[model samples]
Target chain A: MINIILNNRQESIDVDSMTVQELLNHKNFTFKLLVVKINGKLIKRDSYDEAVIRDGDEVTVLHLVSGG
Target chain B: MSEMIDTKIRQHLSRFRVGIAGCGGLGSNCGVALARVGIGELVIVDFDVVEKSNLNRQYYFLKQVGLPKTEALQHNISLIDPTVRITSHNTTIKSDNVAELFGGCDVVVEAFDRADQKVMLIESMSLLLPDTPLISGSGMAGWGNNHLIRCEQYGNLYVCGDQQTEVSPDVPPLAPRVGIVASMQANFVMEILMRKKV
Candidate 1:
């Protein structure tokens, strides 16, 4: 069981192993232009592939869409 | 020649002082527009030089290439309105000098191209001038639909860019998009000075 926190919401997901991209896909989030903070450290877009989701890891995804 | 002026609007605009960081694409357009419309005072800051590439979207001429942005922008505003009191800062806004750079400014405009600088400026404003309005720009890129441009206000800070739902890495930053965002920023400043809802 992996505990995922998104925008301050906590949820437990049953997945064997997952990457950031896969998690976003599962959430139906298609936008790639986003800032991912895992435990308060920003994960670069390119490093999304190397980041492995772990159990009880907190992740915050902030969408940077157009807003003035 | 004494002319009749809206006493309320004149009184409102007279006391406002605007600070514009990054005098490049968005800053140039916004600064010029503000000065042209008789804003009380404008403090323009930029640590860049005019390059040939900037002519596309910046409110400068080809002859201004190689000139310091602050100096060139000061001249540009002078041509627009000689009476507009303009202050130019030829250095970049940093954590060390942000307070002095933007001090006494009623509104701060974040128009830098670098994302880190934008974040830094916002944080600095939050710390140094929490009560002042910070109008920021983001997602003014690509050649998408013009109607997508919108303005949002968050407390004392306002952002003029695309909504958080439509952003892609493929979106290339361009001048026209930035211009639209800059105009929105100017409008927000005007509204704030006019005591209108953002």
Candidate 2:
């Protein structure tokens, strides 16, 4: 298991081969326009599959909906 | 005017260049604030147009409905401060082109409506202009606790909004709430220009 902050809240999750893509699917974030960051570093859409999530990483998932 | 802002600060503000990414509620409102304070130049970028619906928040005249947002906003900003050198870009912005489009800007404001564009602007600018401050908005939807609409800085990025609230059809982005966030974003720009840590 690993600890991470999801959207500013602390949570523990299984660490088995966990990647940002898997973590997003596991949490069921349905929004298409998402800004994913781990420890304040942006994870672009292409790298989601390869970006790994580590223990104690601060993850921020922000949605940029179509409105101003 | 000197009573509102010191002459020295006002003089310094006239030398800053601000680039706004969207011209809807956030972009238009933020531009107006900066223009009123006499920010020298503004590059307003948006491909959309004013509609009857936009009257609720965006800056535009009823007669200017069909005009592109960039054009309409430039006209409006000029009304606030004729000396403001305004450039309007009627084009779509992508990660590949944002840096090129906004390269001359001292501070680039992320006023986009979509999440992807906001993130793209931030990421692209971080790569292309790492030292430039990027101000963005998030979570200001509906009539939220206005006090929650405060400024937060992460590295070179400064954001003003209630970071988690969102707007929906039922809970639209009301005038007062949106204006407050826009004003706060403009305040951050001035602070950065003045070298004040506020």
Candidate 3:
């Protein structure tokens, strides 16, 4: 079981050994132009697949498109 | 007394200062719109000069081709409103002087053409002037159909542009799209000064 906190809400998911991309997919976030902050560090888009999500990790996703 | 207070508030709003970076497509239009609407003080910053290529989108006359963008924009703003307090900085906003460039502004508008410069300006503003609101644009190029723009807030920062999956480095932005986004930026600044949440 992993604790995924998104935008300040905590969620319990039954997934083990999942990559960042897989975690985003599980949460139904399909936008590719998003900036991912995991534990206060920005994860680059190229490293999304290589980064692993552990238990009790906090992830904040921000959409950076469309604004003046 | 209420009438006096209204007069004072109007004076403050008229004296509200805005800083515009880049002075290209988006910057030119934003400055013009702000000046036309009676924004009292404007600080225009840009390091580039006018070329034949910029004449398509940039608001400068053919006779002003060799002039710095900041100077040309100041001239244009003067033509629109001679009483407006307009200052032009013919230098780039770097890490060292960004704070100084944006010092007394109520809001900072990022209208740079380059994505890298835009990112750098945002980071610098976050560090230097955290309380000042920053409005930036992205994805205004390559046949975008959505003319009505949406603004997304990030703390004190607001960004406007299309939500494209990938941004090509070489894609040239057109006038109509950049104008749409720049107007939104100016409107956002107005709303902020008017105490309205964008």
Candidate 4:
């Protein structure tokens, strides 16, 4: 089990490790214009598939799009 | 005391500079609101030219249809406050140049229409201008959810919108809701500027 903070909430997930992309999928964050950060560091869109999320990592997925 | 506070806020506003990336629905309206409130300077960038369809929500007149959006917005803002200095850029805002364009601004408003563009600005500004706040609009399509339109902050980023309303054939970006979110973004800039002074 992995205990991590999603947004500002705490959650315990079944996986011990996963990619940022997988974490986003697990949380169902389908918003296209999302900015992801792990432990205060930004994970660029192209790096999402490579960036790893582990136990107790603070992951932030922010949806910053509504249209102009 | 209230009058003194107002005077101080005005002083702060008059010394501040803001950047508006993309002079469209959100940028044009936000720029005008900030100018009306006496913001000292605005750095606006947009590559597109104003079209007849833009008049529906953008702060542009029919006569300015062929003009670049940045130029049209600058002209419109000047009409509101002649003292407000504006530097208009008739170019696209990309990730690599975010810092070069808006590095000196106290705050930047990300007002792009497409999701990809919004993400580009938000991510670039968050990284390049780590100290400056980026206020953005999201989910302001249709109308009448005044209560739902709110500001959410994430580090140096501020997003204003319903956070769900995507612009589509069915739910198009209208003036009322777009103005609401844009006004909120402008208002947040004032709040940030005032707080910085304190």
Candidate 5:
């Protein structure tokens, strides 16, 4: 088990290493306009599957909602 | 005989140009407010036409129901202040032309309604115009959550909205709520423009 800070909140995941896509799915972050940043580095949409997040990584998933 | 005293502030405001990404609810209303506030130049882009339904929240008149949004908005702003330069592009904003369109502006306003489009604008702008500030709106639908609407800053991106209210059948985009967010976006643009160079 590894603990990571997700959006200013710490959460314990059952994996030592997981891709950004995996972390998003695990957290159920299905927002279409989410901007993901791992350790202050932005992860592009295409690179989500390749970007890996390890223990103690700081991740911020900003949900940009749909409206006007 | 120059009959002017506070020409410094007006001249300062007339030196900057702002770009509007989508001339829908937020864009239309924000554009009007900026124009009224004496923004020097406005670069607006929109491929959609004004419909009767847009009259609810958008800043358009009944006579402009069939006109293109960019043209109609240009005319409205001209009526407000003909001296204000309005350069409008009546076309769809894609990633390829995003920089060419708004690269020169001091600030860009992302007023798109769709989440995908918002993402596209933010991604393209962040890559193309890294230094330019982007003011966007999200979740300004329906009403009664006036207190929830707020502005958040992330790097150069400033988003003004509740950040949660997704538009659905139950939560439609009304005037007051949309206006609140639009005013916030315009206010941000004003603040960015009014800042001293450092």
Candidate 6:
């Protein structure tokens, strides 16, 4: 069980995979322009598969889309 | 004859070449504000067309509907200051060419509406142009309280707005709140220009 703030909102999730990429897949985030930050540290795309999502981590999943 | 200006703020702005990513509500309003002050140059990017729906908050006329956003906004801003130079890009901004597109700008305005585009702009701009400042908006949605709109800066990335509201079908972007955040972004740009030596 891990608790993380998703886009400023607090949430807790229990998932099988513990990597950052796995969490994004579990949450079904398919945004093309997503910048993931874990505990204030930016996670580059290359590190997603290896970066671990620990318990009580603060994550900012910024999904860039087209509105303006 | 040259018109006499009262303050040096106007002179400071003349040295800036601001890059605007979106020409919608935020970009259009901010451009108008900068144009009023006669910013030296602007690079306005938008791959959208003016619809009847955009007239509520965006700076476009009813007759301008169906025209491209870049063209419409350029025409509108030109009315405020004919001397201010504006370059319009009729394409979307992606990671690959974003830097090259706005390379010569002094500051970049990230007025995108989508979360993905905003994130892309922030990341790409920060990575490519580390020293250049970027102003963006978040959570300026619905007809909520205008007082909630404020700005917070992280390094050179300054984000303005309520920082909570997300646009939805029920909670739409209105003129008042959008105007507040847009003006805040524009004001920050001018303030940065004034404080920093060009």
DockQ of each candidate's interface versus the true one?
Answer: 0.17, 0.39, 0.22, 0.66, 0.58, 0.26
What is the lDDT, from 0 to 100, of the residue B136 in candidate 2?
89
Q: Model 2, stretches more than 4 Å misplaced?
A: A1-18, A21-31, A53-60, B1-5, B196-198
Off by over 4 Å in 4: A64-66, B1-5
Candidate 6 regions with alpha-carbon error over 4 angstroms: A1-42, A45-68, B1-7
The candidates, ranked best first by TM-score, are 4, 5, 2, 6, 3, 1
Instruction: Give the CAPRI class of candidate 3.
Output: incorrect
What is candidate 6's lDDT per residue for B47-72, written digit by digit as tens?
99999999878989999999999999
The residue-by-residue lDDT of candidate 4 on B1-198, one tens digit each, is: 998876666677999999999999999999999998888899999999999998889999999999999888888887877899998889888888899999889999989999888888877876777788889888899878788988877767788998888888888898999999899999999889877862
lDDT of 1 by residue, B1-198 (tens): 233465456555766789998888889999988886678789999999999988878888999999999899989999987877888889968988989988888898988876667666766776678788889887676766788777766556677877442325666566788788889998899888887432
Task: Give the winner by lDDT.
Answer: 5
- Model 1 per-residue lDDT at B165: 27
Give the whole-model CA lDDT for all candidates, comma-separated: 0.77, 0.82, 0.77, 0.87, 0.88, 0.83
Error of 1 at A35 (Å): 10
Local error of candidate 5 at B130, Å?
A: 1.4
TM-score of chain A of 6: 0.85
Q: How many backbone clashes does candidate 3 have?
A: 9
In the predicted model 4, the residue pairs found to clash are A65-B138, A66-B138, A66-B139
Q: Candidate 2: global Cα-lDDT?
A: 0.82
Worst 10 residues of 6 chain B by lDDT: B1-10
Shift in Å, residue B162, candidate 5? 0.6
Over the true interface, candidate 1 deviates by an RMSD, in Å, of 6.3
Tens digit of lDDT per residue, candidate 1, span A1-68? 78777655788888966888888888888864565656645566787788877877777664454421
Report, for all candidates in order, the number of backbone clashes.
9, 1, 9, 3, 0, 8
- Model 4: DockQ score: 0.66
- Could you tell which candidate, 3 or 5, scores higher by TM-score? 5
Instruction: Please report the candidate that would top TM-score against the real structure.
Output: 4
Better of 3 and 4 by TM-score: 4
